[model samples]
Target chain A: MKKILKFIKYMMTYSLLILLAVFFTFPFLWILSTSFKGPENLFTWPPQFIPEHPTLENYVNVFKRIPMARYFLNTVIITSLGVVFQVFFASLAAYPLARLRWKGRDLVFKLILLPLLIPMQGALIVNFITIVRFGLYNTYIAVVLPSAVSVFGIFLMRQHYLSVPPEIEDAARIDGCNEFQVFWKITFPLVRPAAMALAIFAFTAHWNSFLWPLIVLRDETRYPLQVGLAQLNSVFEANFRSVAAALVLTMVPILIFFYFTQRYFIEGYKGAVIK
Target chain B: MLSRKAQVYLIAFSFLIAPLTLLAIFTYYPIIRGVVLSFTDYNMMLGKAKWVGFRNYIELFKDEEFYVALKNILRYLIVVPFIQFFSILLAVLVNKRLPGIRFFRTLFYVPVITGAVVVSITWRWIFHIDGILNGLLLHMGLIKEPIAWLSDPRYALCAAMFVTFWRGLGYYMVIYLAGLQNIPSELYEAARIDGASSRQIFIRITLPLLKPTILFCFLISTLAALKIFEEVFLLTQGGAETTTMMYLIYDYAFNRYEFGTSAALSVVFSGILLMFTVINFKFFRAGSEGR
Candidate 1:
């Protein structure tokens, strides 16, 4: 009787898990099915889980209707530039704030974190004007420049840097290493996993960023995938299959990227929130 | 040769120069400039500003859409408690050492990872007049007529809030899961040995332990709801009485080219956000002290 009860409880748990899983993923699955469905009726009485006649025609049509490849290239360029700048600037900026004992260090750090308390939503317009004034409008740099030095990135990196022991750095200094060498050879290497976590965070953020790219990029060819997909959404409003295919194309790369680096995401959040 | 003190200063300066300059230009300058711009008539073509004190603020106070946007955003906060409650439950469910748990976690997070544009567009299709939701409801005899979910003012904001709630679940679930993992298993073990029920364990141990994570999520989700834009922009185009403050700001500056008015709206919106943040901090402090 105890064994039967255990089996019943096990079945209940699995059933609940499966039910919730379907609830979360059914939309994407429906879109996937829709993308593959050939010219058949989409709004059936019971709804079709599987396509009756699957085809690659919608995928082909998405490419033809929009410059999907160019958008992907733009997104790649923008995302890489953003990721590099965010990680590089964050890693460098955090070093002084964390490792160095200098005048006004605490003051500087507090000032940096002040924006988190008082967010400047007005930056949306002012930054646009700044971008245009600097002749960066319609360029990829315009999209990446304003957000290049993230305050949260600096904070995250600094938290990681502070956890590095001072003895290692002192030993390097005693061995006749200069401050730069101590940072380069001893301290920087110690915090590489933190840097990796920051980079992964930066990657996802830049990959999905939309509104700024939309405001800054004027030329159609300069549009990132998010902006491009949004435009495709409007253009293909009635054409569900084409829109579904375009969305799939846009989502697959990020989804695959997440699948591999998901561990960093969880670990990164753990470090960030648990502190 | 420089002394060690000088060398340290030089290193710090060199490391900070680029990031600091960028921050000053992008972050700090904007705060001051945005306020200044709010009082002036900004000309994009001429690249000039003419001071017109109180006019922009006066016009903003007179706008009906502004209040609608404000009301919609406050109404959007209804999703926060639902998201937090469900996500904590989800975290507990998946926290178990079950088979295929990793797959389920990934599946749940698919909506969040896919980004807002994809998620919004997918839902836009699903919320269409003849969409799957309507068809399913009709087949189940839930409704006699196919309701225009996105076009009708009554249902449009609700639909947008639903998408936000759905996409947000997995994101917060992951965070809550991390919070749950931080709780030592010994507490659960101790409770079990005392013959405590699962409900008692959760209420006494889990709820109190997850306080910090809960507070953090509340602060962020509240702010996110206030600044909501993409879903409204994509789904209803801010029609059907669904305009949010962020969308209003975007539309004013970008579409209408009313830079001064947009700046005014932004200032007001920031003030609202700052007020909420202060309230949250106060609540957090009070909760911690009471504990």
Candidate 2:
């Protein structure tokens, strides 16, 4: 009887989990079903959860209607540039702030974090003007330049760096290693996981960035995937099938990327938040 | 020939030079420049500004849309509490050592990872006049006519809020889940061995331990709700009286080319955000000290 009761409880838990999962993912499933529907009446009294006659017509139309490849390339360029800059600069800036004892170290760190309290809404127009004045109005760098140094990235790296045992660096220094050698040979390698986590955060942020890119990039060819997908949304307002296909295309890569790197997200948050 | 102290200082400065230069040009310079721009009539063509003093602020106070945007953002705060409540519940639900829990977590996070554009567009379809939501309601005999979720003024903001709530749940759920995991298992085991119920264990242990995470989430979500723009912009195009402060700032600068007024609105919005943040910090400190 006890065994039977345990089985029933397990079943109940799985049932509840499945139910909530459906609630979360049904929209994506509905879009998937819509993307494959073949010229049938899409608006029915009872919405179809599956396409009666599946076709690749909408997918083909999505590629034809817009420069999907160019958008994808642009997104890759922008996301890569953003990720490299954020991780590189954050790691460098955080090293001194976290490890080295210099005059004004605490003051500089405090100054960097001060902006977190001040909202950046006011910077929108001014940054745009700055970008234009720099003769980078239509360039991809303009999209990534302003946000190249993420304060949150710096904070996260500094936290991780502080956790590293100082003795390891001191031993390296006692062996006649210089400051740069100590950072390169001993300290940075210990914080590789934290750097990986910061990279992942920067990746998703840059991948999903829309507004700034839309404002900066005047040429259609330079439009990132998010901005491009938004353009498709308006252009295909009445054509739900094409829009569904485009959304699926944009979603798959990131979902796949997340699937592999998701463990880092949970672990990263655990390390960053708990302390 | 350099002293050890000076060499260390020089290395630190070199490491900082690039990042600091970028931050100054992008983050620091803009804060002061934005305020100065608010007091001038900015000309894009000549890249010049003529002093206008209080003209922009006076004009902003007189605009009716400004008040509508302000009220709508406050109403948007209605989502924050609901999101927090649901997300905490979700974090608990998926916190078990069950099989396929990671898959379920990923499913829930799809809306967030897909970015705002895809989620908004996908939702726009579901909320269409002949959309799935109405179809489901009608088929279930709940209502005779289809409710225009996005178009009708009565339901438009509510629909936007629902989307925001939906998209935010998974993001916060992950954070809360991390918090949940951080709680030592020994605490739960101790409670169980002491003849305590699950409810008692949760109330006595989990909630208190999760306080810091809860405070952190609340502060960010409150700020996010106030600064909401993408949903309003995508779902309704700021139509049907759903314009928000961020939308107004964007509209004034881009759509109307009123940089001075836009900068003024941004300053106002930033002040509002800073005030809320200060309040959150004070409340958090008080709560922590009370314990």
Best by lDDT: 1
Rate residue A240 of model 1 by lDDT: 95
| TM-score for all models, in order of appearance | 0.98, 0.98
lDDT of each residue in A1-275, candidate 2, tens digit only: 99999999999988988998898889999998899989999988678877889999999999899988899999999999999999999999999999988788999999999999888678899999999999999898999999999999899999989999889998998999988888878988999988888888888899989889989998889999889987886678699999999988888888898888889988878877767
lDDT by residue for model 1 (B1-291), tens: 989788788999999999999999999999999999999999999999999998999999899999999999999999999999999999999899988898889998899999899999999999989999999999899999999999899999999999999999999999999999999999999999999999999999999999989999999999999999899999999999999999999999999999999999999999999999999999789778756
Model 1: per-residue Cα lDDT at residue B187: 97
Instruction: In candidate 1, list every pair of residues with a backbone clash.
Output: none
Query: Across residues A1-275, which tens digit of lDDT does each residue of candidate 1 receive?
Result: 99999999999999999999999999999999999999999999788978999999999999888999999999999999999999889888999999999898999999988888897899999999999999999999999999999899899889989999999999998999987788888887988887887787788888889999999998899999999988985677689999999988998898998899888888878877877
lDDT of each: 0.92, 0.91
Task: Compare the candidates by DockQ and give the number of the best one.
Answer: 1
TM-score of model 2 (CA atoms): 0.98
What are the RMSD figures for all models against the true structure?
1.2, 1.3
Model 2 native-contact share: 0.75
